[model samples]
Target: MPELLTTSGNIALTPATFQHRLLEWYDRHGRKTLPWQQDKAPYRVWVSEIMLQQTQVATVIDYYRRFMARFPDVHALAAASQDEVLHLWTGLGYYARGRNLHKAAQILVERYGGEFPVHSLEAMTALPGIGRSTAGAIIAISTGQRGVILDGNVKRVLARLHAVAGWPGKPAVERELWRLAERYTPDERLDDYSQAIMDLGATLCKRGTPSCLFCPFEDVCLAHAQGEERRFPESKPRKVLPERQTIMLLLRNEEGRLLLEQRPGAGIWGGLWCFPQFDDREALSRWIDAKAPGAILEPAWNSFAHTFSHFRLHIVPQPARCKRTGHVSEVDTLWYDSARPANIGLAAPVKQLLNASRPFAAQPSF
Candidate 1:
């Protein structure tokens, strides 16, 4: 394991000096042209903060612009339908953020007359998807209130600056980092300071090959001084991703409508439309034989492999043409107009498969 720098052999940081040095560095080189920095309105800040969670700033840039164009304000978000919100948030992996944003907007409209409650931390956290760090950031940036932010970028910056040991996810390390964050946050110019610190961490104090030469705190950064900046906040143990095999049945009617089912709202790819999936080939064959006895099973067109954070999905696509127009009792399915897949929430990979199969679906034979 790598070592962290110690202050007076104490191994902890001197918060006052650290804050002064970091703030000075921020004034000189921190990011200043981000979209969120242009405006400090509660809605703008809140939207950007939510979108930035577990997502890169570069990736969030265009998404933020389009999202703002659609919603414009909290009231607009609250009024939009769930489908509409999800549609705008497609390609953004975390669907829960969109749902929570919509929920919080509704709450804001109902409870606070469409205005964000900026006075208290408790009031802010009471809104959906706004945890401690998010609530703190909103209040700090929008209202100039002093608070701590502990996102991944800030965590990496602090861990390297102080050479804090142990995983940041652990409670003890998190508590120490929180204390450091609170200590460094200036009482005045709180919003600019907050954004500055985040920008510093993101731009110069990055995860890989950090540009320490341009960093404001390079002079005093313990990890940099110790020649082990990349080793701070020791990496966690890795786990093997389990693999799961499944079959996706593409059942189509004579009129070229493909069957898709809406997934239940609480699991992998929740609330998205996907083809009827089965765990085993035996079960799938039995389902097809019993449900559509006279249907013609076409050769498999393609296979899709998608990896989630926790597991890997092997989707085997089997196309079949059904003779009957009526619904099958066993399968929870519906035949959708193949051209208008946007009517439902289809996962990205499934959408790709549909698009790939468009030419085949348009032809007379499967």
Candidate 2:
């Protein structure tokens, strides 16, 4: 008999039993109709995996569909401009993913002839934004290649099942989880097994409220035995997030075209278009005097906060009416006409402000 690992009183588990039960559960209740599941092509799988990072399934569906429609393949994505890729990726947050996806696509077209190296995990990981786990997912899900994935969902499931201690973000905790992941990975049904574990995590072993009764591993989960399922995957230590302040100039020309500047390719809102920002009113005043010399400044709108992963940005939307100044014409800047807006990426807050500014622009005066 295979050596069994005891969990709760009377119940025991082995690698074989765990795999069998999980796959059985998956065959009956796993997600099958997801857009990417319909076509297990490497390109499609890769894109979906990238989009799903730090994003929920429901939110990623529409974005995935639209992105696939526009850039159907690696070659197409490689040929497209970064602006269009980022435009489709707007509202998805994590602009770095979109940027890296574009960069990787270009590399694939140039080096691999637009084909994903499905069999080589190292080759896949060498690409920008494709981590070890993500690469493993692409290989395992898209191909029948043996691959082990330890994404967030998988990490949660593993942590709880084994009653893993310490924060998963820590090196020691992660290494142990990876060891368990590798040990349990079966030799056959690579695709189904990979998806099964992920599905088990996503559906039953959810982070906040796990359906322990419905879980196949309920009898054998060490965390359930201890009656502290949520406690196994320890949370990351938290610190007070710093705050930042900025004033965005919503300068509208006589033609009602709003002034937007392209943010640098490396910092916040990278590769996206946003209203001109200033540290203070004095700096804003000087820019207006130099660039839009005769622009009329209006009272600042109600301030609000936009929180990022590390900081909270307090924004003051300062509206203005201006005439086209020659100095304002720059390659990095554009006069955005709402009626015929250019296809470009806008940060979520910027998009919301633009929608809100329509009525403001219609007013006779600022």
Candidate 3:
């Protein structure tokens, strides 16, 4: 008989029954020392959880620590400028997450007095970027409340255990995941259990080449029983990401200051700073013709390519020197001294291009 099948005092291997084995395995081997788990506060959990989305744990640790040191609490985050908040989040891609976090902090301050709205999942989810799963994480992990979470890790773990077919993104799969999540959640040791399952999935039942031998449900995992662990959590339908092309103007003044613009609150790299962009060579020429009529434009070395999850951006870098100082009447634009990096948020592609071209700017072969 399987170890899991014989455990639980002869009861069937159920969610509640499964809970004991999970917690026991967790007590012996689960992750208990994450940075977020150390402080275990709602605000901290919320920030870490948001950062962990579409991001890895090793990458989030330094960012989390630096962010906490800078903001310390919701009030600090709310009081700080959006630029300040985003500046702290440089290289942590998905700028929208930083924008939403700043917006949510402001909302929390206004409504909940910056207290994180504990004990009320509804209130927390009302804030920008705080979804049901995130709110549930904050409540359960911080406040010891019984809350069910279906984050990617938990989803993968549950999906494989039950051999749940289809992509978890589907509404039907989501409903099933929620139902199973609720069933597995226990009233006692809520915080530990929540963290345990997440840890189990993250550390053992990973997306590829999972350590099934170490998993608590190894004996009863349907996917394991059938030798289809890799096939259980079916992936989403595949589609080719669209390609986007743009020309970025890398203009510098006599003082060697680079021209940067604050992008709008929507679209790619929203709420971040970047060079003025145009569709192609013609658009770039037209913009220079209109804005900096006497500017000397020259194409940089090779173009740069940046890939987002949903699209690929092919960027043509054009370096120019404006004959005279002028201002645009459209958006908030500024001249930043390239000698000294600006303490503001820069899109990854923008930063990459800027750094790559700066040393060769004066000695350009073009």
Candidate 4:
């Protein structure tokens, strides 16, 4: 590891020195009032960690509060149905995280008596969604144990501090950062130290326009020294996201209830409720004709796009007022009432479409 000099250019900033300075800053500015921080229970910390993965703290607060209100502990979460758990998770983009979290809770309740295996990193990582860094955070934050985390925020902070080269997604680069994370993690005050590093990165060493002057490592940060604070922790190689188009069927019943289908358990928007989709207008028309012979198909609503990490989905919401012939299966299909929405998961785009359909809800009587 390269040595970093202090502001006077006279002394080296060792690991101990680094921890001390970070903790000092944390004592003043670190986020101590986050919903999860108030109660450092392993379950709470674990949920917060999962929610915060690839999600901003500001966006997670309300979701976390609602989730905790429903499922107060691992036992409660485990006992709840997947639909109920996922219902609370709607609007939180990553559905897989929500699924794995519920599964892990079940595993913990069944195998570990609903208690976290705080002493065992292996046990913690063995859980469905708990990776190494997340496990480290849970143990350290909940128990104040010696645990090191290399979350995105920490990765950015450390990458610039030593000016680490290469995209952090690379195995080599990630391994090096993990080593640095451990080297600097203090023995005492593990909870504060963990939060401090993450806070420093989020607040000061931001992805764009970092506040270099206010940073604790302002003078010692190698990237700052080179006037290339954003250069380190190289970005992943870019790729053109493929665009896929689909027609979303917004079939409404006489009672003004919208029809929704539970998506297959493993795909885009898995395990969530979504409007029936068709490849094109012809296919949509065919399904409508076969299912509801006298259903009135309205003009297609304005097209919109919902971009995912891998692809862009162009959605054309095809609204329809239909008379049902027989009872619809309740297993995978549902009649959703907007006023009394069931606790079921809906993707962001589906929710948007539902909201958009509100103004046009009073269809002409047949």
Pick by TM-score: which candidate is best?
Answer: 2
Clashing pairs in 1: none
Identify the runs in model 2 with alpha carbons over 4 angstroms from their true place: 1-12, 360-366
lDDT per residue, candidate 1, 183-290, as tens digits? 777787778778877887788888888999887677677888888988976777669989887888888887887778777766776666788889987888887787
lDDT of every predicted structure (CA atoms): 0.80, 0.89, 0.84, 0.89
TM-score of each: 0.88, 0.95, 0.93, 0.94
Report how far off residue 361 is in candidate 2 (Å).
9.0
Cα-based lDDT at residue 177, candidate 3 = 89
TM-score of 3: 0.93
**lDDT per residue (tens digit) for residues 1-366 in model 4:** 244343333247689989989999999988899999998999999999999999999999999999999999999999999999999999998899999999999999999999999999999999999999999999899999998899999999999888889999999999999999998998999999999999998988899989998888887888887788879889999999999999999989888888899999888899999999999888987887776677889988878898999999988888989887344446799888888889889999898878777755653321
Task: Say what the RMSD of model 2 is.
Answer: 2.8
* lDDT of model 4, residue 185: 93
**Ranking of all candidate structures by their TM-score, best first:** 2, 4, 3, 1
- In Å, residue 236's CA in model 3 sits off its true spot by 1.2
- Candidate 2 lDDT over 1-366, as tens digits, reads 332444433235667887899899999999989999999999999999999999999999999999999999999999999999999999999999999999999999999999998878899999999999999889988887888999988899889888889999999999999988987788777789888898888888998999999998887788988899979799999999999999999999888889999999988899999999999999998998888899999888888899998999999999999866566988999989888868899999898888888754543322
Candidate 2 lDDT at 262 equals 97
